[model samples]
Structure formats: C-alpha cells, structure tokens
Target: MASGKHRDNIKQQSKAAAKKSGNSIASRISNSFRNHQQVAVDSLDRLLASISGTLMIWIMIAIAMALPLFLLLFLQNLQQFGSDLDEASQISVFMNTTTEMPRLEQLRDELLGRSEIQNVEIISAETALQEFQASSGFGDILSGLDENPLPPVLLVTPLAQDAAVLQPLLASLQDYPEVDEVQFDLDWLQRLYGILNLAQRLTYMIGLLLALGVALVVGNTIKLAIENRRDEIVVVKLVGGTDAYVSRPFLYTGLWYGAGGGLIACVLILLAQLILQGPVSRLAGLYEGEFALVGLGISGFFMVLLLSAMLGWFGAWLSVLRHLRAIEPG
Candidate 1:
C-alpha cells in the first residue's frame, strides 16, 4: 500500500509540473503584450513631463490651425449657396407701373434678341406684393395697405456662367428711355467672392505657420525626452540593446505629442463651430437661407490626424538618431 501511494504521489507531481510550465508560458506571452502597450503610454507620459512648456506649445499650435480651418469650412457653405444661384442669372430691372404695355413689350423683344440672354420673367407689382405678403408672415396686415405700391419688376437670367454680362446689360438698361432702374445685388456676391479668396489665401498661410509650430514643438519635445532618458539609454545600449530598440520609446513619445495635439485641435474646432453655429444659423434664417453649419468632413479629419501623427513620428525619429549615438557607454 505504501509503494502504491508513492507511485500515485509521483504521478500527481508530474501533472502539477506540466500545468505550472504551461501557466508560465502563458503568463510570459500575456506579459509581453502588456509590456508592449504599456511601453507606448509610459514613454508618452515620461516624454511629456520631460519637455518644458510642451503643453502650452501644443495648445498654441492647435488654436492657430483651427482658426483658418474654421473659416475655410464656413466659406465652403457659402460656395454651396452660390451653386443654388446657378440657374437664375439674377438680374433685376424696375419699371414704372404706369409705363405703357407697348413699351414693356418692346423691352422684352429687345432682350430676346441678345444671344447672352437665356430666360427672362417679369413680375408685376401686384404679383410681387402678393409674394412679399406670403413670405413676410404679415399676410393679414398687408391687405390693409392703401395699394400694391410695389413697382413692376423684370427678372433676367443669363445664358452664360460668366457674371460679367450684368455690367454691360446694366449699362444698356440704365440708358433705356423707359427704364426707371436696373439693379443687381452684385455687392453681396462680390463681397462673398472677396471673403472666400481671402479665406483661401489665409488658410494656406495659417497652415504653413501652424505646421512650422508643430514641427518645432515636436522637435523640442523629443530633445527633452532624450535628455530625460539619458541614463536609461546608456544602460540599454550597454546591455546589447539594438539602436532600433532604444529608438522605439522616443519615437512613440513624439507620436503621442503630435497625436494629442491633433486631437485637441479637432475638439477645439468642433467646439468653436458649435458655439458659433446658433448665431450664424439665426442670421442666415433672417436672410431666408437655410444655412446649416458644416464641419470638417471625414477625409479632411483623417488627413489632419495623419499629418499630426507624421509630425510627431518624424520629430521623435530625428531626436533618436541625433542623440542616441552619444548615449552609448563606451
């Protein structure tokens, strides 16, 4: 019985050993994954702490980047508004309601002769007043007016996309003996065009300057990271760690800086848009336009994220290459 018990004990010991070995291997693999993930986060923390004024630098860059980016997106909506105006050449002419029908008929015939004219519709004062009443939310009040009072209006549409025709047409119409007034609210369109042009140019300039800020911030951050890990790096190189191995943590550091800054930029832009959206939409509503504030589309968001990550990665890589050689203990 004693010998049988001993044999049983031996068998039990063998099974326990196998389980222990299996657990050890599994634990090692789990630990490796944990270490890999932790390394990146830890490196970022260490790097961030090492860099003096890094937080301030990143915030500054993000704010600068968001400004023009916001303006650019806002102007994109304006461009869409112009698209709605495509079909209507948007020419307005005013004539005295007392003008003879024959003269108005002759004016129409002359307009039809112009090759540059596509479609023309004339609205009489009565029809114009009715339209105004319906849209003004004062339909009941408008009926109490003494008379329609509005003058006869001619609305013109051009055949060509070129808006320059309005100038020549306006000159001719002003000279017409029967014409009282020729008007095109070209001021709004022209002002919008000027603003859009300025936004585009400013966008580029802001982008360049902000990008330089990003590069400088990242570079300085990586430099500080190198200085912080001087002792650890020296020991790492002394212990047969490859250059690649030593560089990994610093590279991750820069990536985190850039990525963090980019994320902040995204949030800032979105927040700013949100804050301004209500007022902007209310103003547009007053003008009879359904102006919905649009944000940075998916592609643009991704590109910005990519640019930020690249900036950080390149900055870290540069720091590692430049400083790591000096960190080796001969």
Candidate 2:
C-alpha cells in the first residue's frame, strides 16, 4: 500500500514541476514582448524630439559634401577641356631656314615613322602667311605689306594629351638638328592641373575638420539629452531597470539622428545641384561643350547615409557610457 502511495506522490510531484516550468516560460515570453514594445515606443518618441537638431546635422554634412562635389566636377570639366585642347596642343616646330623644303619633307617623312607623334601639318612660308592672315582677319593689312615675313613651320602634335608628358616630348623633338624653336601653349593646361591638385588637397583637409566637428556636435547633443533626463534615469534605476535597458533608447536615438541627418544632407545637395543645373547648362552651351556634371549615384548616397547614422550612434554611445558609469554607485 505504501509503495503504491509513493508512486502516486512521485507522479503528482512531476506534474506540479511541469506546470511550474510551463508558467515560467509563458511569463518570460510575455515579458520579452512587452519590453520590445516599450523599447520601440521609447526610441520613436526620442527620434521625433530630435528631428530639428538632426536636420541641422544633415545640412552641415550636405554643405561639406557639396563643396567637394562641385570642386571635383569643375576639375573633371577642366581635365576634359585640357583633353579637348590636346587636339590643338600642337607644337609649331620651325625648321632651320637654311634647310631646303625637300630636306624638310624628308625630315617630316622620317618623323612620320615615330609612333608618339600625331598628325603633322607642314606649313610653308606662303601657307604660314596665308593662315596668319586668315586667322587674324588681317588680310587688308597683309595686302599692304609687300614682304611675306612668316617662316616655314611643322605643327607637330603628340599622340599623348597630358601636359607633363608633352613637355618632355617637345624637348626631344627640339633636339633635332633641322628644328629651330618648338612653340606650344602648354602653360594653361599645366596650371589647370596644378590648381586641381591643390583644390583636392584643400577639400580633404576641410572634410577632416568638418567630420571632427560633426562628432563633437553629436556628442554634446547627447550629453544635453542625458542631463535633461537625469530624474528619469534615477527613476529607472530605482525601478530596477538594467543599464542596457536605459542605454538602448539613447543608442536608438543616435542612430535615428545620423540616419535623418544623412537623409537631409542628400536632399540639400540634390536641391543645390538642381538650382545650379540651369545656369551650368547655359554656360556649357555658350562654350559649345557637351560636358555634363555627375551627381552622387545610388551607392554613394547609401554610403553617406550609412556613415552619418553610424557617426551619430557612436557619439551617443560614447556619451552614454561615460555618464552612465558616473550615475552608478562606486
């Protein structure tokens, strides 16, 4: 009778333990869902409050990005213009006046074998005078002057378009015994290249300074938010809230700030670009150029957005950690 009673007691104990386990699991799941909802609500509320500041953040980012973008585009156009001018970057290689036309023709033929040189226009004295008269619109003045003073020249164009490479090539061509002076308008292109490099370096330096400024701005803002909610933080501590629970909302707030600011920056940049587009097009048309500036593509847009959000999050996290520890007991 006692053995049977013992078996029944064991069964009852097992049933009670199973029921307790099931209840605990249900309670945990309910609490987990509730916490998720609470965190979501908290994050959303903070994000709304932060919109105005976030807008300012994005505007700053936009300005920083836009300056570099415009400068880069202008530099690209400058390089393109140099390339276009390359067709005309021809060197006027004047032959030694003593060299006969036949010998000059022989020399031209010999030069034709060189792969580095583009097309060569052999301008005889009469042809040079004629071209100068036509281009200068000085036909009437030239008709009055009985003497034709222009010399025979070979307009030598290099196949390569870069100013750096062209100068060395010109030096090599000038070494020829039959060649006198080699004249080329290489100054403008060289200066343009130099200016472009300087501008790029300046933009990079400014960008670094501005990025640091952004991080500071975010940090200060988070610090202020933390200060404002001192009592609320105290209440959370009294209510047995874990540090992670208190910190999650602020972390979310930072994420939102970065993402929102990044968005605003992108919008501002596009708006600025749109505003400038008409004037740019008109200017390009005046120069008879088909060049069009490119804006940031989809990948670039996403990258900027991601970076902004990340920065904001990091700044907020840094502030929260520094302050949260100070709030707790030693």
Q: Estimate each model's TM-score.
A: 0.58, 0.63
Please report the TM-score between candidate 1 and the true structure. 0.58
**Which portions of model 1 show Cα errors greater than 4 Å?**
1-38, 45-58, 84-87, 90-191
lDDT of 2 by residue, 1-330 (tens): 999999999888867876877756677679778886787677767657776765676566556545655565556656776677656677889877666788878878877788888777788878888889889998889979877767689888778766667768789889998888888877777787788778778877876676566666777777877888888888888777788878777776776666776777677667766887788789988989765656656887898788777877887888899886567532
- Kindly report which residue stretches of model 2 are placed more than 4 angstroms away from their true locations once superposed: 1-45, 64-87, 97-164, 228-252, 317-330
CA lDDT of each prediction against the hidden true structure:
0.75, 0.75
Model 1: lDDT of residue 46 = 73
**Residue-level error in angstroms, candidate 2, position 183:** 1.5
How does model 1 fare in lDDT? 0.75
lDDT of 1 by residue, 1-330 (tens): 999999999888966865877756677679667866887988767756856666775676577667667767777877777656654546788888776556666778789789877766778777889899889888887798887767878787766544476667778878876678887775567566667778888888877777777777777767876898788888988887778778888787777778777777888877877898999889988989777777876787877777887887887777777877778686
Checking candidate 1 for backbone clashes, the offending pairs are: none
